[model samples]
Target: MIRSGVLQITLREESATTRIPARPDCLLGAGRQSNAIDRGDVDRTLRRWGASFRTSLVFAARRSLGHIGSQHIGYDDTERSLGMSRTYRVELGDVARARDALSAVRDLAAVAQARIESLATTHDPARSHPSTDTRVDAAMNAHDLIRATPALAREQGDERIVVAVVDTGVALGHPELRRKLLAGYDTVDLGLGKVGGMELVGDSRGADFTPRDDVGHGSHVAGVVAAQGFRLSPGMAGRSLCLPVRVLAAARPSGSRRTIGVGALSDIDCGIKVACDLGAKVINMSFGTSEAHIDAGAPPPHREVVDYAVARGVVLVAAMGNSGQAEKLFPAAIDPVIAVAAVDERFEVSSFSTRGKHVTLAAPGERILSLDRHGYRLSTGTSHAAPFVAGVAALLCARARRRGVELGTREVRDILVRSAQARPADGHRDDIGHGVLDADAALRTLDADLSASPHGRTHTHG
Candidate 1:
């Protein structure tokens, strides 16, 4: 029987002779053929290798894909044409056994790929603490730098425009964020029993509807996007709604005072797909893994779901990482996603912000004021910088909808890049991409485009 560790396996499409059974216990029962293995063979193989069937990784998506068209902010013909592949999860006793099983699974003709689920963490730097001074003026100055005030004056954003914060999870009861958050999902699945030496999930056991934040990173990121300005602190998109999808959980390593946000790639992929299916117009991913951490020749993680989200007309924003190096990071480095780097109040790129060709824009991420579980606090990282762009993307989508136009992922990215204000001395550099994010300029460009286009026609950039 399956005991501890988890591994994800993707089966070949052509080998399938039967559909994946609805029962969670059923393991790779895709059918029997000259080349393909049946359910009995799958069970015997796993049992022989000291592993067992856990669950289907793409089962939820398969069930929900057909129903996504009925959701609010429905997809167009392009989105409906995309298809999902069959992937499954299995449990093993130890890391060595898990690795062996992965190798064995790869030999099977039906298996396309197999991997030990990798973990991703939030972009917050080590030992980063929140500033005690939580004043409104400091937050407003950062917002003003990006001309968010003027952009909000033009369009305060729409409740219909949802920006999914796919991070740890948000504080559901935070006064500043309660009204702005929509129902979210949690995809953290740490098998039936904990894997030895990899107890990353602090309190989270498995998937659930309640996405409460045990760690504060997700709450802070969510606040940047849609926190309601209380007494002094102002939210970037006050009218926009934040959908909190919990993929990362709190994990405090040995001798560390702070809990780092950690999550498996399987959960993250599921979270992204869920957010897209749930009608999120924009998704802010504030976590990443540096290129150094990835093994050579490994497939880029989250490629499928990122493509799925983009095809469905959802604008994606991701942190450029805080490694202080010119390294590539997944999801962010992947094309179609708008990668954002950290900039300080002076519009200088943060020392910690990773520089790469994929970076699309810069946002205030140094000592920036945002929300925490306890109350408002100031933190710094590309994690916070990403949400600022996400908040702005939500506003752009709202403005487009108000003008009776639909903005796709490419259109939104084009507007953000075109209207970005270049730094005077540095010009467009690798660290900051086009330049610092200018909310007012982007909205104004969108307005001009809609004005130039015929009424009721969708305007897209070449």
Candidate 2:
């Protein structure tokens, strides 16, 4: 778990002034020589910037250092893939101190960039509608609206494809999800204390192996993507494996008994990277932050890692946000990552679904029935809708693999947009990029394109 109230500093490429001696205590190993900056240099520099006694810094990927190249169950290749050695997380006592630290690091010759880490909550603002009905018929509306049944009938998805659900941890013991889940990781670092308005529900220590969902958001999202479809309705990619990366944790705000899901941007970034390293073909992000919440022109949160995952050939999908305004929300707004808006059974955009030029497509999301920590539950917002797209992406990947055809992120996205059903008469609209998702259409289109090419060329539309 990456701690909150910290500033992440990425050092510049190796230079005379930037290359300080590394300490034994520092986690800079053979491959991490690029991060060999002296701890004393950082401490002295911070003191010069008026950093309080409470300010401290540590390697951003300290927990992952020992796992490098290990055969262990929780091995993470983030440090190996993302040049993580050049990055460090500076912990601060307060927001004012964090501000000072971020400013001070810029003056350090070794520091190339620095920003205070922030948190993003789950996109689903509506309360969960818990129900006793676990019958398969109860959860058919959303899937039926998306034509998931017929799509699955054509391709039930391949077990080789893994969809990483980066959200509040999943319910490990849920009957619908247990067997379908691969071992997961928890990234919520409690650190010395909590920073945001919320508090961790159970464990007080930093993140560990277990990713049990105290808040049920991740479970619901996972169910939408790959639930076993035994007692509840089948998921979009029922046969695909689900890898839960617990970035968001259960949070209870002051004077509120109700719990919500919240996670720091750093943790989310690590979770995404780890998921990619662990062989996830598709990553589902059911949360986001608005442009107004971030600096006027600062890069979107998780931009670096998002690019890393895309480069690794992983397809990224995110919610269009529940604001229902035309403003942009990050990650989803970021290019190449599929942005999904919520549509009702009538195939019309939901009032709460955010609209923006970045929106890539729409799917059934209103009162969508999915899994909960306990049993079946109904939830709304783009959070649920994004998984529908993610699941479809998995289907496309699995189908491509079965046909011995390679599908990159761009190809998958292109297939989705071209095969989307019911485009607005005028053309691409902000509410729905092309139109509502048609999973079966996407697979059929992919097959037609593969068959037409002598060398199995992937289809693309400019």
Off by over 4 Å in 1: 1-4, 17-53, 62-85, 137-140, 191-202, 295-298, 423-428, 454-462
Candidate 2: which stretches are off by over 4 Å? 1-4, 15-42, 50-83, 93-95, 127-140, 192-194, 454-462
Residue pairs clashing, model 2: 1-187
Q: Candidate 1 clashing pairs?
A: none
What TM-score does candidate 1 get on C-alpha atoms? Answer: 0.86
Q: Can you write out model 1's per-residue Cα lDDT over 1-462, one digit (the tens) per residue?
A: 112356666667665323343211121133211112346455456656744444453434434343422121233443333324355555554445765666676677776766666668774775257667887665536787899888888888889998899998988999988678898877765443333233454555654557788788998898888877774345676587889998887776655567767777767887888898788989999888666655343367787777788767788999999989999887799888999998888788999999988888899887677788888777888998998899888888888888677777778888888899865355467898889899999988888878887452345421
Report the error of model 2 at residue 421, Å. Answer: 1.1
- The lDDT of each candidate is 0.72, 0.72
lDDT of 2: 0.72
The sequence of per-residue lDDT tens digits that candidate 2 reaches over residues 120-147 is 7774655444556655555538777777
